[model samples]
Target: MPMAADEIVSLIVAGIPDAQVEMTDLAGDNNHWAARVVSESFRGLPRLKQQRAVYAALGDKMGGVLHALQLTTAVPVQE
Candidate 1:
């Protein structure tokens, strides 16, 4: 079964405690999702590292349950 967007968001938030996650189904299918994650942990991290962190949160589900994820990670924008 395909992973739900909420499930993916929950996993990311669980791993990154203070993350703000917004998940959208880009193709209207659960398999293809776009996620915007804002976290303090991404403050100084490079883009690749930030993506890796999010992927790590999903563990081994990458190739199985979760098909593809379009992720954007950023530190919360300062006012």
Candidate 2:
């Protein structure tokens, strides 16, 4: 079964409370998704670490229920 977009957002928000997540259905199928996550907590963290955090939030769902994900992470700009 494919995962719901809200489920992905909820998991990320649950793990990283300050994260702002935007999800897109890349292939018009729930199985393929693109997620852009922006968070103040990501400041000073390496991009690899930031990506890892998001993946960690998704847990084992990445390969099983969720299928493919194109992820982008960023720190919120201070203006």
Candidate 3:
């Protein structure tokens, strides 16, 4: 079964707490996703680590139920 956008966002929020997540169904199949994640926690992390955090949020679902995810991560601009 494919995961829903809400589920994805919920997982991320649960993991990061302060994360703001935007999810897109890239293929309309609910399997392929593009996620833009922004959080203060990601501020000093390397891009690889930031992405890994998001993937970890999804837990063991990635490459299985979640399929492919095109992820973009960033720290919220201080303003």
Candidate 4:
């Protein structure tokens, strides 16, 4: 089964309380998704770690229910 876009956003936001998440369905099937997450918590972390946080948010769903995920993570600008 595929994951819903809102589910993805909710999980990521749950993981990163102050996160901004945007998701796109690459295949239009809701199975393949691309997520861009921006958070203050990611500020000093490595890119890989930032992405990992989003994945962690999804828990076991990452490779099972939601198989194809293209993730991009960034820290919010300090302005």
What are the models' TM-scores? 0.92, 0.96, 0.94, 0.94
Q: State the lDDT of candidate 2 residue by residue for 22-71, as single tens digits.
A: 99999887879999999998999999999999999998888889879999
Query: Per-residue alpha-carbon lDDT of model 1 for 13-63, expressed as tens digits?
Result: 888899899999988867888899999899888999998999898888887
How good is model 3 by TM-score? 0.94
Tens digits of lDDT, candidate 3, 35-72: 99999999899999999999999898888888888999
Off by over 4 Å in 4: none
Candidate 4 lDDT, 1-79, residue by residue in tens: 7889999898888988999998999989989999999999998899999988888988988889889999999888777
Q: What is the C-alpha lDDT of each candidate?
A: 0.87, 0.93, 0.93, 0.90
Better of 3 and 4 by lDDT: 3
Cα shift from native, residue 56, model 2 (Å): 0.9
For candidate 3, the 10 contiguous residues with the lowest summed lDDT are 60-69
Relative to the true structure, candidate 1 reaches a TM of: 0.92
Say which candidate scores most in TM-score: 2
Candidate 2 colliding pairs: none
Pairs of residues at least 3 apart in sequence or in different chains that clash in candidate 4? none
Q: Regarding TM-score, does 1 or 4 come out ahead?
A: 4
